[model samples]
Target: MKNIFILAFLSVAIFSCGPGSKTIGDTSSSEIATNDTIKIANEALEYEVIIVEPGFDSWLISQPPRGYYGQTKLESKNRQFVAEYNTRVLNPTKYSRNLYTEQINYDAAVDYGYEVNYLLYNYFMYFQEKYNEKFIGGRN
Candidate 1:
Protein backbone atom coordinates (compact mmCIF):
# COMPACT_ATOMS: atom_id res chain seq x y z
CA MET A 1 0.00 0.00 0.00
CA LYS A 2 2.73 2.48 1.00
CA ASN A 3 4.85 1.45 -1.96
CA ILE A 4 1.94 1.98 -4.34
CA PHE A 5 1.31 5.49 -2.89
CA ILE A 6 4.98 6.45 -3.13
CA LEU A 7 5.22 5.27 -6.75
CA ALA A 8 2.12 7.22 -7.75
CA PHE A 9 3.40 10.38 -5.98
CA LEU A 10 6.80 10.15 -7.66
CA SER A 11 5.26 9.66 -11.11
CA VAL A 12 3.00 12.70 -10.64
CA ALA A 13 5.86 14.85 -9.41
CA ILE A 14 8.13 13.85 -12.32
CA PHE A 15 5.44 14.43 -14.92
CA SER A 16 4.52 17.82 -13.41
CA CYS A 17 8.13 18.96 -13.56
CA GLY A 18 8.57 18.09 -17.21
CA PRO A 19 10.41 20.19 -19.77
CA GLY A 20 7.40 22.34 -20.64
CA SER A 21 6.96 23.56 -17.09
CA LYS A 22 7.76 27.19 -16.25
CA THR A 23 7.93 28.46 -12.70
CA ILE A 24 6.29 31.74 -11.66
CA GLY A 25 9.59 33.62 -11.31
CA ASP A 26 11.03 32.57 -14.69
CA THR A 27 12.25 35.58 -16.72
CA SER A 28 14.50 35.55 -19.83
CA SER A 29 17.30 38.10 -19.93
CA SER A 30 18.97 36.42 -22.90
CA GLU A 31 15.96 37.07 -25.13
CA ILE A 32 16.02 40.76 -24.24
CA ALA A 33 19.73 41.01 -24.93
CA THR A 34 19.33 39.28 -28.30
CA ASN A 35 16.57 41.71 -29.29
CA ASP A 36 18.81 44.65 -28.36
CA THR A 37 21.67 43.25 -30.46
CA ILE A 38 19.43 42.81 -33.48
CA LYS A 39 18.23 46.40 -33.19
CA ILE A 40 21.79 47.72 -33.06
CA ALA A 41 22.91 45.64 -36.04
CA ASN A 42 20.00 46.80 -38.15
CA GLU A 43 20.67 50.44 -37.27
CA ALA A 44 24.31 50.03 -38.20
CA LEU A 45 23.39 48.57 -41.58
CA GLU A 46 21.07 51.48 -42.29
CA TYR A 47 23.75 53.98 -41.42
CA GLU A 48 26.26 52.25 -43.64
CA VAL A 49 23.91 52.15 -46.62
CA ILE A 50 23.02 55.82 -46.24
CA ILE A 51 26.67 56.75 -46.01
CA VAL A 52 27.45 54.83 -49.23
CA GLU A 53 24.69 56.34 -51.37
CA PRO A 54 26.54 59.52 -52.41
CA GLY A 55 29.70 57.62 -53.30
CA PHE A 56 27.67 55.19 -55.36
CA ASP A 57 26.01 58.04 -57.23
CA SER A 58 29.33 59.72 -57.91
CA TRP A 59 30.88 56.47 -59.18
CA LEU A 60 27.95 55.88 -61.48
CA ILE A 61 28.13 59.41 -62.82
CA SER A 62 31.87 59.29 -63.49
CA GLN A 63 31.88 55.88 -65.16
CA PRO A 64 31.05 57.16 -68.67
CA PRO A 65 30.42 53.57 -69.72
CA ARG A 66 28.41 53.05 -72.85
CA GLY A 67 24.78 52.04 -72.42
CA TYR A 68 22.50 50.15 -74.83
CA TYR A 69 23.28 51.06 -78.44
CA GLY A 70 20.80 53.35 -80.33
CA GLN A 71 18.64 54.03 -77.29
CA THR A 72 19.03 56.89 -74.79
CA LYS A 73 21.32 55.07 -72.43
CA LEU A 74 21.79 58.04 -70.14
CA GLU A 75 18.06 58.22 -69.42
CA SER A 76 17.87 54.48 -68.83
CA LYS A 77 20.85 54.53 -66.49
CA ASN A 78 19.40 57.52 -64.68
CA ARG A 79 16.12 55.68 -64.21
CA GLN A 80 17.88 52.61 -62.88
CA PHE A 81 19.89 54.82 -60.56
CA VAL A 82 16.72 56.41 -59.24
CA ALA A 83 15.05 53.07 -58.63
CA GLU A 84 18.09 51.68 -56.83
CA TYR A 85 18.48 54.86 -54.83
CA ASN A 86 14.84 54.75 -53.75
CA THR A 87 15.06 51.12 -52.76
CA ARG A 88 18.20 51.75 -50.73
CA VAL A 89 16.66 54.73 -49.02
CA LEU A 90 13.45 52.88 -48.27
CA ASN A 91 14.98 49.80 -46.72
CA PRO A 92 12.27 47.89 -44.90
CA THR A 93 12.74 47.44 -41.16
CA LYS A 94 10.84 47.38 -37.89
CA TYR A 95 12.10 50.68 -36.54
CA SER A 96 12.24 53.04 -39.54
CA ARG A 97 9.25 53.47 -41.82
CA ASN A 98 9.61 54.84 -45.38
CA LEU A 99 7.56 57.98 -45.67
CA TYR A 100 9.47 59.69 -48.48
CA THR A 101 8.51 57.75 -51.57
CA GLU A 102 7.09 60.81 -53.30
CA GLN A 103 10.22 62.77 -52.50
CA ILE A 104 12.35 60.11 -54.15
CA ASN A 105 10.11 60.11 -57.22
CA TYR A 106 10.37 63.86 -57.47
CA ASP A 107 14.10 63.68 -57.12
CA ALA A 108 14.23 61.03 -59.80
CA ALA A 109 12.34 63.34 -62.14
CA VAL A 110 14.82 66.10 -61.51
CA ASP A 111 17.73 63.69 -61.91
CA TYR A 112 16.59 62.72 -65.41
CA GLY A 113 17.99 66.04 -66.55
CA TYR A 114 21.25 67.67 -65.41
CA GLU A 115 19.77 68.95 -62.15
CA VAL A 116 20.79 65.89 -60.10
CA ASN A 117 24.05 67.48 -59.01
CA TYR A 118 22.42 69.56 -56.32
CA LEU A 119 20.27 66.64 -55.11
CA LEU A 120 23.26 64.34 -54.94
CA TYR A 121 25.25 66.96 -53.09
CA ASN A 122 22.50 67.40 -50.50
CA TYR A 123 22.08 63.68 -50.12
CA PHE A 124 25.79 63.27 -49.46
CA MET A 125 25.76 65.95 -46.82
CA TYR A 126 22.67 64.52 -45.15
CA PHE A 127 24.12 61.02 -45.20
CA GLN A 128 27.39 62.20 -43.76
CA GLU A 129 25.71 63.96 -40.88
CA LYS A 130 23.39 61.07 -40.13
CA TYR A 131 26.13 58.48 -40.37
CA ASN A 132 28.36 60.38 -38.03
CA GLU A 133 25.56 60.87 -35.56
CA LYS A 134 24.35 57.27 -35.51
CA PHE A 135 27.38 55.01 -36.06
CA ILE A 136 30.52 57.05 -35.53
CA GLY A 137 29.23 58.48 -32.25
CA GLY A 138 29.54 62.01 -33.69
CA ARG A 139 33.32 61.63 -33.83
CA ASN A 140 33.65 62.45 -37.54
Candidate 2:
Protein backbone atom coordinates (compact mmCIF):
# COMPACT_ATOMS: atom_id res chain seq x y z
CA MET A 1 0.00 0.00 0.00
CA LYS A 2 2.97 2.30 0.47
CA ASN A 3 3.57 2.25 -3.28
CA ILE A 4 0.00 3.32 -3.89
CA PHE A 5 0.33 6.14 -1.40
CA ILE A 6 3.60 7.30 -2.98
CA LEU A 7 2.05 7.19 -6.44
CA ALA A 8 -0.90 9.24 -5.32
CA PHE A 9 1.35 11.75 -3.60
CA LEU A 10 3.59 12.05 -6.63
CA SER A 11 0.64 12.48 -8.93
CA VAL A 12 -0.70 15.31 -6.84
CA ALA A 13 2.73 16.93 -6.65
CA ILE A 14 3.27 16.71 -10.39
CA PHE A 15 -0.15 18.12 -11.17
CA SER A 16 0.20 20.86 -8.59
CA CYS A 17 3.42 22.26 -10.06
CA GLY A 18 1.53 24.28 -12.64
CA PRO A 19 -0.50 27.56 -12.29
CA GLY A 20 -3.39 25.57 -10.82
CA SER A 21 -5.89 22.96 -11.93
CA LYS A 22 -5.16 24.17 -15.48
CA THR A 23 -3.22 21.48 -17.33
CA ILE A 24 -1.70 21.37 -20.81
CA GLY A 25 -4.28 21.37 -23.64
CA ASP A 26 -6.83 22.23 -20.96
CA THR A 27 -8.84 25.34 -21.81
CA SER A 28 -11.34 25.01 -18.97
CA SER A 29 -8.96 27.57 -17.44
CA SER A 30 -6.04 29.72 -18.83
CA GLU A 31 -3.48 27.01 -19.62
CA ILE A 32 -2.68 26.35 -23.32
CA ALA A 33 -0.85 23.48 -24.96
CA THR A 34 2.12 24.87 -26.89
CA ASN A 35 2.41 21.67 -28.92
CA ASP A 36 -1.16 21.94 -30.14
CA THR A 37 -1.68 21.21 -33.81
CA ILE A 38 -5.32 21.29 -34.84
CA LYS A 39 -8.54 19.71 -33.57
CA ILE A 40 -11.80 19.56 -35.51
CA ALA A 41 -14.77 19.38 -33.25
CA ASN A 42 -16.94 16.34 -33.92
CA GLU A 43 -14.81 15.78 -37.04
CA ALA A 44 -17.28 18.09 -38.72
CA LEU A 45 -16.99 21.56 -40.36
CA GLU A 46 -16.88 23.56 -37.11
CA TYR A 47 -13.61 24.06 -35.27
CA GLU A 48 -11.21 26.40 -33.46
CA VAL A 49 -7.44 26.32 -33.12
CA ILE A 50 -5.71 26.53 -29.74
CA ILE A 51 -2.99 29.09 -30.62
CA VAL A 52 -1.50 29.45 -34.05
CA GLU A 53 -2.00 32.88 -35.52
CA PRO A 54 -2.47 36.25 -33.93
CA GLY A 55 -4.43 38.52 -36.29
CA PHE A 56 -6.76 35.67 -37.14
CA ASP A 57 -7.44 34.64 -33.56
CA SER A 58 -7.97 38.25 -32.61
CA TRP A 59 -10.52 38.79 -35.34
CA LEU A 60 -12.17 35.48 -34.57
CA ILE A 61 -12.64 36.18 -30.86
CA SER A 62 -14.10 39.60 -31.66
CA GLN A 63 -17.22 38.12 -33.20
CA PRO A 64 -19.89 35.86 -31.78
CA PRO A 65 -21.38 32.50 -32.78
CA ARG A 66 -23.73 31.72 -35.72
CA GLY A 67 -26.57 33.78 -34.28
CA TYR A 68 -24.30 36.40 -32.80
CA TYR A 69 -23.63 38.33 -35.99
CA GLY A 70 -25.89 39.39 -38.84
CA GLN A 71 -25.84 37.31 -42.01
CA THR A 72 -23.92 39.92 -44.02
CA LYS A 73 -21.32 40.51 -41.32
CA LEU A 74 -20.89 36.84 -40.62
CA GLU A 75 -20.35 35.98 -44.25
CA SER A 76 -17.86 38.80 -44.73
CA LYS A 77 -15.95 37.93 -41.59
CA ASN A 78 -15.95 34.24 -42.35
CA ARG A 79 -14.60 34.91 -45.80
CA GLN A 80 -11.83 37.07 -44.41
CA PHE A 81 -10.94 34.45 -41.82
CA VAL A 82 -10.86 31.72 -44.42
CA ALA A 83 -8.68 33.72 -46.72
CA GLU A 84 -6.14 34.62 -44.05
CA TYR A 85 -6.14 31.10 -42.65
CA ASN A 86 -5.60 29.55 -46.04
CA THR A 87 -2.59 31.75 -46.51
CA ARG A 88 -1.06 30.30 -43.39
CA VAL A 89 -1.67 26.66 -44.35
CA LEU A 90 -0.41 27.32 -47.86
CA ASN A 91 2.94 28.23 -46.30
CA PRO A 92 3.91 25.31 -44.09
CA THR A 93 7.47 26.48 -43.40
CA LYS A 94 6.09 29.36 -41.39
CA TYR A 95 5.89 29.23 -37.60
CA SER A 96 2.17 29.90 -37.36
CA ARG A 97 1.88 26.32 -38.50
CA ASN A 98 2.64 25.58 -34.88
CA LEU A 99 -0.90 26.75 -34.07
CA TYR A 100 -2.49 23.90 -36.03
CA THR A 101 -1.98 20.91 -38.27
CA GLU A 102 0.43 20.88 -41.21
CA GLN A 103 -2.26 20.27 -43.84
CA ILE A 104 -4.63 22.75 -45.40
CA ASN A 105 -7.60 21.87 -43.25
CA TYR A 106 -9.79 24.94 -42.79
CA ASP A 107 -12.93 23.02 -41.98
CA ALA A 108 -11.60 22.13 -38.53
CA ALA A 109 -11.20 25.77 -37.52
CA VAL A 110 -14.46 27.08 -38.91
CA ASP A 111 -17.12 28.21 -36.46
CA TYR A 112 -14.46 28.09 -33.75
CA GLY A 113 -14.29 24.30 -34.11
CA TYR A 114 -17.17 23.78 -31.67
CA GLU A 115 -15.92 22.62 -28.24
CA VAL A 116 -12.44 24.10 -28.66
CA ASN A 117 -13.83 27.62 -28.65
CA TYR A 118 -13.23 28.29 -24.99
CA LEU A 119 -9.75 26.81 -25.11
CA LEU A 120 -8.82 28.68 -28.27
CA TYR A 121 -10.13 31.90 -26.85
CA ASN A 122 -8.07 31.58 -23.73
CA TYR A 123 -5.00 30.73 -25.77
CA PHE A 124 -5.56 33.70 -28.04
CA MET A 125 -5.71 36.22 -25.23
CA TYR A 126 -2.72 34.73 -23.50
CA PHE A 127 -0.73 34.50 -26.72
CA GLN A 128 -1.42 38.09 -27.75
CA GLU A 129 -0.53 39.52 -24.36
CA LYS A 130 2.57 37.43 -23.90
CA TYR A 131 4.02 37.66 -27.43
CA ASN A 132 3.35 41.36 -27.90
CA GLU A 133 2.35 40.59 -31.46
CA LYS A 134 -0.65 39.43 -33.47
CA PHE A 135 -1.47 35.73 -34.09
CA ILE A 136 -3.19 36.03 -37.46
CA GLY A 137 -0.70 35.08 -40.17
CA GLY A 138 2.51 33.10 -40.33
CA ARG A 139 4.55 35.84 -41.92
CA ASN A 140 2.99 38.63 -39.93
Candidate 3:
Protein backbone atom coordinates (compact mmCIF):
# COMPACT_ATOMS: atom_id res chain seq x y z
CA MET A 1 0.00 0.00 0.00
CA LYS A 2 1.14 3.53 -0.69
CA ASN A 3 2.14 5.30 2.51
CA ILE A 4 0.05 8.45 2.77
CA PHE A 5 0.88 9.36 6.36
CA ILE A 6 3.16 8.21 9.14
CA LEU A 7 3.89 9.43 12.71
CA ALA A 8 7.21 7.96 13.67
CA PHE A 9 9.44 8.63 16.64
CA LEU A 10 12.30 10.97 15.81
CA SER A 11 15.64 11.58 17.47
CA VAL A 12 15.85 14.23 20.19
CA ALA A 13 19.00 15.83 18.80
CA ILE A 14 18.85 19.42 17.64
CA PHE A 15 20.29 18.62 14.19
CA SER A 16 17.56 16.10 13.40
CA CYS A 17 15.81 18.30 10.90
CA GLY A 18 13.79 17.71 7.68
CA PRO A 19 12.18 14.52 6.47
CA GLY A 20 13.87 11.10 6.57
CA SER A 21 15.44 11.99 9.91
CA LYS A 22 16.69 9.09 12.01
CA THR A 23 14.03 7.45 14.17
CA ILE A 24 14.72 7.06 17.88
CA GLY A 25 13.13 4.78 20.49
CA ASP A 26 13.41 1.19 21.54
CA THR A 27 11.60 -1.29 19.29
CA SER A 28 12.56 -4.39 21.15
CA SER A 29 11.03 -7.72 20.30
CA SER A 30 8.66 -7.43 23.22
CA GLU A 31 7.28 -4.10 22.00
CA ILE A 32 7.03 -5.35 18.43
CA ALA A 33 5.05 -8.37 19.57
CA THR A 34 2.39 -6.10 21.03
CA ASN A 35 -0.13 -4.08 18.99
CA ASP A 36 1.81 -0.85 19.23
CA THR A 37 1.40 0.01 15.56
CA ILE A 38 -1.81 1.29 14.01
CA LYS A 39 -2.13 0.66 10.29
CA ILE A 40 -5.11 1.99 8.34
CA ALA A 41 -5.12 0.82 4.78
CA ASN A 42 -7.53 1.50 1.91
CA GLU A 43 -6.47 -0.51 -1.10
CA ALA A 44 -9.23 0.91 -3.23
CA LEU A 45 -8.02 4.42 -2.48
CA GLU A 46 -4.38 3.36 -2.87
CA TYR A 47 -3.47 5.00 0.42
CA GLU A 48 -2.25 3.84 3.80
CA VAL A 49 -1.58 5.52 7.14
CA ILE A 50 0.78 3.78 9.53
CA ILE A 51 1.08 5.31 12.99
CA VAL A 52 3.75 3.71 15.16
CA GLU A 53 3.26 5.77 18.29
CA PRO A 54 3.20 3.84 21.49
CA GLY A 55 -0.03 4.06 23.56
CA PHE A 56 -2.03 5.44 20.65
CA ASP A 57 -3.76 2.15 20.03
CA SER A 58 -4.81 1.82 23.65
CA TRP A 59 -5.91 5.43 23.82
CA LEU A 60 -8.01 5.02 20.70
CA ILE A 61 -9.63 1.97 22.20
CA SER A 62 -10.68 4.04 25.19
CA GLN A 63 -12.33 6.69 23.03
CA PRO A 64 -15.72 6.50 21.40
CA PRO A 65 -16.40 4.10 18.56
CA ARG A 66 -16.10 4.93 14.86
CA GLY A 67 -19.77 5.85 14.45
CA TYR A 68 -19.74 8.04 17.50
CA TYR A 69 -18.72 11.01 15.41
CA GLY A 70 -20.05 11.76 11.97
CA GLN A 71 -17.70 11.60 9.01
CA THR A 72 -18.36 15.26 8.23
CA LYS A 73 -17.44 16.24 11.78
CA LEU A 74 -14.29 14.18 11.63
CA GLU A 75 -13.36 15.67 8.28
CA SER A 76 -13.88 19.19 9.58
CA LYS A 77 -11.75 18.65 12.65
CA ASN A 78 -9.12 16.88 10.55
CA ARG A 79 -8.94 19.78 8.15
CA GLN A 80 -8.38 22.24 10.97
CA PHE A 81 -5.85 20.01 12.70
CA VAL A 82 -4.03 19.26 9.45
CA ALA A 83 -3.80 22.95 8.60
CA GLU A 84 -2.34 23.92 11.97
CA TYR A 85 -0.09 20.87 12.01
CA ASN A 86 1.28 21.64 8.56
CA THR A 87 1.93 25.20 9.58
CA ARG A 88 3.87 23.97 12.60
CA VAL A 89 5.76 21.50 10.44
CA LEU A 90 6.79 24.31 8.14
CA ASN A 91 7.89 26.53 11.04
CA PRO A 92 9.78 23.99 13.06
CA THR A 93 12.00 26.65 14.60
CA LYS A 94 8.94 28.13 16.28
CA TYR A 95 7.66 24.73 17.36
CA SER A 96 9.03 21.41 18.43
CA ARG A 97 10.78 20.02 15.37
CA ASN A 98 10.66 16.52 16.74
CA LEU A 99 6.90 16.63 17.26
CA TYR A 100 5.87 18.26 13.98
CA THR A 101 8.35 16.74 11.59
CA GLU A 102 6.18 16.07 8.54
CA GLN A 103 3.20 17.70 6.92
CA ILE A 104 0.08 15.63 6.58
CA ASN A 105 -1.23 15.31 3.04
CA TYR A 106 -4.95 15.58 3.55
CA ASP A 107 -7.25 16.86 0.83
CA ALA A 108 -10.75 18.01 1.63
CA ALA A 109 -11.85 17.26 -1.92
CA VAL A 110 -11.10 13.57 -1.61
CA ASP A 111 -13.36 11.21 0.24
CA TYR A 112 -11.06 9.23 2.55
CA GLY A 113 -13.98 7.27 3.97
CA TYR A 114 -15.14 7.21 7.55
CA GLU A 115 -12.48 4.98 9.02
CA VAL A 116 -9.57 7.07 7.87
CA ASN A 117 -11.11 10.30 9.10
CA TYR A 118 -11.99 8.73 12.41
CA LEU A 119 -8.46 7.47 12.98
CA LEU A 120 -6.91 10.73 11.87
CA TYR A 121 -9.16 12.76 14.14
CA ASN A 122 -8.41 10.56 17.12
CA TYR A 123 -4.73 10.60 16.31
CA PHE A 124 -4.75 14.37 16.52
CA MET A 125 -6.49 14.19 19.88
CA TYR A 126 -4.03 11.60 21.14
CA PHE A 127 -1.18 13.68 19.81
CA GLN A 128 -2.31 16.82 21.65
CA GLU A 129 -2.81 14.97 24.92
CA LYS A 130 0.50 13.16 24.65
CA TYR A 131 2.61 16.12 23.64
CA ASN A 132 0.66 18.77 25.54
CA GLU A 133 0.24 20.68 22.30
CA LYS A 134 -2.94 22.33 21.10
CA PHE A 135 -3.67 22.85 17.44
CA ILE A 136 -7.02 24.52 17.87
CA GLY A 137 -8.57 26.69 20.52
CA GLY A 138 -11.38 25.71 22.95
CA ARG A 139 -11.24 22.52 24.92
CA ASN A 140 -8.48 20.09 24.11
Q: Among these predicted structures, which one has the highest TM-score? A: 3
lDDT of 2 by residue, 1-140 (tens): 99999999999999889776755445632222332334434546443343444344445555454454344443444444445555666777764566534443444334543244444444434544555635453214
Per-residue alpha-carbon lDDT of candidate 3 for residues 38-130, written as tens digits (9 for 90 to 100):
788888878899888878887888999979999999999999999999999999789988998898999999899998899899899999999
Per lDDT, what order, best first? 3, 2, 1
Residue ranges of candidate 1 with Cα displaced over 4 Å: 1-71, 92-103, 106-140
Please, what is the whole-model Cα lDDT of each candidate in the order they appear?
0.41, 0.48, 0.83
| Stretches of model 2 off by over 4 angstroms after superposition | 1-66, 102-140
TM-score, candidate number 3: 0.75
Clash numbers, per candidate: 0, 15, 0
Query: Deviation in angstroms for 71 in model 2?
Result: 2.8
Model 3: residue 133 alpha-carbon error in angstroms? 0.2
- Which candidate number would show the highest lDDT if scored against the true structure? 3
What TM-score fits each model? 0.24, 0.32, 0.75
Give a tens-digit lDDT track for model 1, residues 7-75. 999999998886776775454766434432211112432321122232344444443333312234434
For residue 134, model 3's alpha carbon misses the true position, in angstroms, by 0.8
